[model samples]
Target: MRKEKRSSKVKDALGSLTQDLIDAGLGSPFTEKELNYYGINIPEIKNISPKKIKVIREKAQFSQSVFARLLNVSTASIKQWEQGTRNPNGATKVLLDLLDRYPHILDYRINKSKRKNYI
Candidate 1:
């Protein structure tokens, strides 16, 4: 069966209602795939260019090592991402997208007493 494309307003309303159901301790009746069947599709993650990655990091005022630590990735991975040698996938891409949308998302300070040394 072909799913009809839904307007963004309809999708947003349905998505919010679905979240409200979950928040009320009643789990969603439909899985993401099932929701897509009705055209309540999840937003796609967009690809970030290496330059954009660098810009995001700089805007966040984090050095490569610090950014890598924040992302739980090796320093090499951040270097590669900035150099266009590799593309971040899966969860990392989602995180980068979030950072792009909300530049101050990672602005919270970690308590020094509770922070682990990553060296």
Candidate 2:
């Protein structure tokens, strides 16, 4: 199958599984055993490639150091991420997803920082 088709299938499966879980009274159960038993690991962040990392940073007009600062990670970590040696996880992954989805937020952040310099 093509990459895009496979991804869409996986997304549809996940959506169906989620709905099934909800229908089965698993939603908001908040217990480890229930989650484990249902085979539901819900930290479903997208995995991005090294090239994508560079593209996202460049689209936001940020250098590696600046992008690292924005993401609150080390410059070395950014380098590793962009080199495909590392993958972002947890809160960093969440932030990167947000930035990728709404790049204008970076402009807003930059403007906010400039305003701070006047104070």
Top candidate when judged by lDDT against the true structure: 1
lDDT of each: 0.82, 0.77
Question: What would the TM-scores of all predictions be?
Answer: 0.67, 0.56
lDDT of 2 at 101: 81
Supply candidate 2's per-residue lDDT for 81: 92
The parts of candidate 1 lying over 4 Å away from their true place are 1-29, 112-119
What is the Cα-based lDDT of residue 101 in candidate 1? 76
**Over the full model, what C-alpha lDDT does candidate 1 score relative to the true structure?**
0.82
Worst 10 residues of 2 by lDDT: 110-119
- In candidate 1, which residue pairs clash? none
Tens-place lDDT per residue, model 2, 1-119, is 89999987876776568658776867754465545544555667888888988888988889999888777789999999999999988887777877788865766555564465544
Residue clash pairs of candidate 2: none
